[model samples]
Target: MTLTLYSNYVNSAGERVRIALALKGIDYEYVSVGEISWEVYERINPQRLMPALKIGDQIVPQATAILEYLEETYPKPALLPADPVLRAQARAFAQHVVSEMHAIDVIRVRRFLHNQLGVDQEGIDHWQNHWFANGFAALEELLARRQTAWTFCFGETPGWADLHLTPQVTKGIARFNVDMAPYPLISGIHKACVTLPAFIAATPAEQPDYPGRVIEPKLR
Candidate 1:
């Protein structure tokens, strides 16, 4: 099976999919959208989103959807648990990161805040940080209540939650400069996840299109 992934290094959504591919030990063609011409990417995805996965002639858009496809196609590693309730929890956790936390802080949202709302850099930063804290606070409470294993969100091994958590925490530290100490469980899980080869290899800094100096934070 031939797989081609079109992604931008700076995008958290893309990073999530990339990490999943790495954990699955799937080798594919990595297309850096940042390095390529806009016309090329436009042809591939009219929406101009990063992290579009091409499986032969079929194209799967959206990072979360791509992750679900990967889990379905390659079930050996098993990103989600077999039990229906556990699977739903995993999906909800992933969605919390993507829909609740990530969706609001993406480039488009930031750009919209700056251009459309006339918000300055400080305002944008404040906005991002507030939401990050809010989401992390809720997640911390849930994890504490559930008494999640130290290794991962709901299981012994890194799964859907860990994939989403790592990238979001990475971005929170590197971009938003948020204090991770408030979310001990999240910080711990992120620390453990990044140590693995899959998470390390799929990090934004390790991507081909990464422009700036890599920020590797020492998670507390």
Candidate 2:
């Protein structure tokens, strides 16, 4: 059966799936959809979200679910550890970002570009920093107490939690001007993540509609 990932080129969740695919070294077809592609995605997923995976005859939605599916179906270099507690920890970390973290998307970037969020610059700055500080505070605590050898989110490997985090780190830094110097463990984990081929292969810049010129200046 052919594995087809239907996603937008610059989506965070979509990027997660891409990393999982790369980590498992699985061959799949990439179908890039536009912002308005939600109209079509609604047919596939009632939620109308990206990063939907079509494997054989099954359709999987939700980013974290897709990652778990990938791990269960193709368990080679195992992303999730064998120990149940460790796996739970990893899943918790992933959930923290996907659920607890705020100001994680390109809201600030869009506001900067259009200046149309009805808020002043000071308000925008406060909103952005507020979320990063709150989220990283939780992340820092998790990493500081982690009992692992590889300095990953979970045991000794880059599991689902680590995969969910790396891209958000990029978004926090490039898009929200998040400084990682405060979160040493997160910084270390992100550093380790980039060294892996799967994480490298799933970078947003490598995607097709990556706002090459628009966000390039701000990225630096």
TM-score of each candidate structure, all chains considered together: 0.93, 0.84
Per-residue lDDT tens digits for candidate 1, residues 1-220, read: 7999998777789889989999899998989876787798888888788789999998888998899899989997999977788788888888888889998887778888888888888898789889999999988886787644647988889998889888999888987789998899988888889899999889877888777775432221
As a TM-score, model 2 comes out at 0.84
lDDT per model vs. reference: 0.85, 0.76
Q: Write the per-residue lDDT of candidate 2 for residues 78-117, one digit (tens) a residue.
A: 8877889877888888888887773244444536633654
Minimal lDDT window, size 10, model 1? 211-220
The Cα error of candidate 2 at residue 3, in Å, is: 1.5
Candidate 1 regions exceeding 4 Å error are 147-150, 212-220
Count of steric clashes across candidates, in order:
0, 0
Leading candidate by TM-score: 1
